[model samples]
Target: MFQGFNLNVSNESRFDSPSTYDEILKSREDNVRESLENFYNEEGLLNGDSLRKEWFPEIENCHVFISHSSKDRELALKLANWLYHEFKIESFIDSTVWGFADKLLKQIDNKYAYREETKDYSYEIRNYTTSHVHMMLSNALNSMIERSECLLFLNTENAIRNISLKEDREQYTFSPWIMAELQTSALIEKKQSPNSQRPFGSLESNKTDIESIVKRAKSFQMIHKANVEHLNNITCENLSEWAKDCNGEKGYNALTTLYRDYAPGCR
Candidate 1:
């Protein structure tokens, strides 16, 4: 992904980089776009050729529901971004969409008053999606849940487990078909808490480089903070290790000087 040994990776987003690993590997952009495009064309799942086409989410039965406790909204958004950009997955969150939809509805009904003298008038009708557009979105959302191969819950395992498609708030909001469709969904837990993992390369890679990093006289603490500044100089093993180590420590010292942090005290 970093453009490897022989060439420089054109400083573009890693997600957009060319796969170029081998003749068989497709470029990242092409791969993601193909996954999205083939969703309608190849399988006949969406049955294209309509004059008015809407956004057809890929991943059959895999309409990714961003299930998270209200506390994790920020993290949920971040996860949604990654899922959409990295995996070309469909991620729908109600946060931004709800706000915009609400504002539009208010403007249409309240702002344009037919009566100049009275504050109240004909009815407070809200501007909403065209029936066709609403139906399209409804079908897409339901299809996402129905054909969903997997379900990604953002740090809400307990809530998701306790959820009832038959008699729950979620079920009440969406139609019965949509709720029932979630039964086929399989949950995939990310498991890494924001404060837990360092969010970088794996840990085993760091084990091998710990000896060299120590030999180089860098602070053992600095080596483990998961800084991307000297990323090329460190191995993933140590970084993941540090993040894991840091998860429970009272202070910075508790994070460093673990058995894995040193290699025979050459320093």
Candidate 2:
């Protein structure tokens, strides 16, 4: 991880509308779909190495990794487009990879886990496959975060909650994915992102309650403490200035200043 930002965004935020980048997103999805098609052989079986390579691709130059709730995917796409338009920055949006993962799982289940007796996929097989797929996906995501120069996590009420825990207040996120990313950002080796010249870069369960689970399910189920204290908290106001400062020839200088202020002694 080079640097991380917990960017507060909401429905009222400028990034809410993705219409501006609809065409670009369509093109991107099409490209990804086509690339995935190559992973299937004439027998219709997926190549293991190809599939693994899809999950863990080589690090690219000058990219930004946008970490946001899947619910905020449109917003993330919009932000990605905005970054490209304003600063010629590319972004690694994992949701694209996630869609591929879902497709891959369906293919795997349909081929091997389906049971004629049950008229559905085997629960045991599904669990087994899911475990392997999720584990690989988690590893791939961490690899990207470590490789990217900066990580901007979209922080919204949709993803986090403030809970009253005994005498103290604590922040938590229901998404295990968010928890994992935050933890990774906190622990990963920090190095200057090539894209700072360039661009881009969970937990637990178990419990023994019914009413408690139901109430929390609608809002804060399977919570993990939000580990954003290590990140720079950025608001829309800060984003606006960052955008202005990143224009034209000032872009590199502006980023250098930002790194200097936020990450002293960092190259």
Candidate 3:
């Protein structure tokens, strides 16, 4: 359990220098490159466990889980990099997991779910496979959210849209994955760290055209309120202050700085 925040951040905001941001992107690319090797085994077969590991995030270095829309991926990446550069706080971006889930599904369907006779994939088997993969990915995301000390949701226009249903204005998100993440953040057990004596804080949808998965998401009535009222709503300005507070501090103390100013009530 941890603290969560909904930040109405500017997508254009650049928190780190160009070179520094490039370094962050390079590092992420390198990490992905390494993980790519694990997709196959000695027999050149898709290793299910290895693919599963991609969704089952065991990120020891990450203290934050960034939840945002696929369109705001660059922004989320920038925020994650900023957290690391400013406060040495690593963050887990769910976009990567979504990618891996797609890859895993492609590998499975290409291998087993296809039918040469019909010149198309077996719809039933594909559905069965996707259900399992999505379940794992969803559970893994929940796990990451629970394990991290903070969750920062980038409440940008790209993430949510305003809808007026019968004169009642409400927020609606197109992606069911985002809906699940927000709901999980809302209901998950809120646990304070042992060091709460100090302070506190803080998915992308599938891209594959596999059986028109995205179309199915659109058919669902996922009307969310973009409920961040319960969370501490912070701005880029507040983040700057948090950075200033972190200037003289080190390690966990720097993180505590955020809790002190924003989540003093957490114990």
Candidate 4:
């Protein structure tokens, strides 16, 4: 955790004396300042390639990847923690796992420290635009998705608003990162053998029966309205269809249903 502010470190003797407590607090503040300075000097700025190589290696295994907008980081973390506690499922949230990106972004925004007129600011901007930041981020995300068993997209209001489907096209054109992750998950699911894993049910199960259930799900359209236009070209077998099937009007009952049907063993 980043610790640049004064810390509340208590000792039995210090707690009895206000002056001593104040002195301890001041000491902690000094230590924190020194640590922060050293951290910045060590990490440097605008070194995406080196950061990527050192920080994000590779995720060999994980149960799920929670996809959400940066705005909903708290909610995403809450969900990840809950999933791990309830079902013993390991999950990845970018804020925690890929925190170097967050730190770099924060450093960039610290105008007082790295003044806009300084060469550091120019170098930072140039690297953000021309360096391997995007590529590294994409690679890291794809690696996580590739290793995970499934993706749990947190469809909160913020996430939906950020990546709302376009009316004109049958494909997602906004929120490139979310769209890319979803497409990657779809591709992974497609590559898996139909008989190998049956999270929802047997692929050989009655097609007519599956279609009937899907039709019923679609009937809830009034409550859970999605961009049907975007879903037109997607096959019935696609996981996207499962998401559409589970969307209810208010809460995520439909999402629960989708998970129950597809990833049955998950809590």
Instruction: Report the error of model 3 at residue 17, Å.
Output: 2.8
Overall local distance difference test of candidate 1: 0.32
TM-score of every model versus the real structure:
0.29, 0.77, 0.78, 0.47
Model 1, residue 100: C-alpha shift (Å): 4.0
Model 3 bad stretches (over 4 Å):
18-51, 194-225, 264-267
- Model 3 TM-score (2 dp): 0.78
Residue lDDT tens for model 2, 52-77: 66644544653567887888887788
- In angstroms, the error of model 1 at 167 is 16
Tens-digit lDDT string for candidate 3 (64-175)? 7889998888888778777777666667888867877777677677677876665567889989989978988888888888887788888888888898989988877877
Clashing pairs in 4: 199-262, 200-262, 246-254
Local distance difference test scores for all models: 0.32, 0.69, 0.72, 0.43
Which stretches of candidate 2 lie above 4 Å from their native place?
Answer: 10-13, 16-28, 31-49, 55-59, 194-220, 250-254, 260-267
Please tell me which predicted candidate would have the highest TM-score against the true structure.
3
RMSD of 1: 22.5
State which candidate, 3 or 4, has the greater lDDT: 3
List ranges where model 1 is wrong by over 4 Å: 1-63, 68-71, 81-90, 94-96, 110-116, 120-140, 155-267
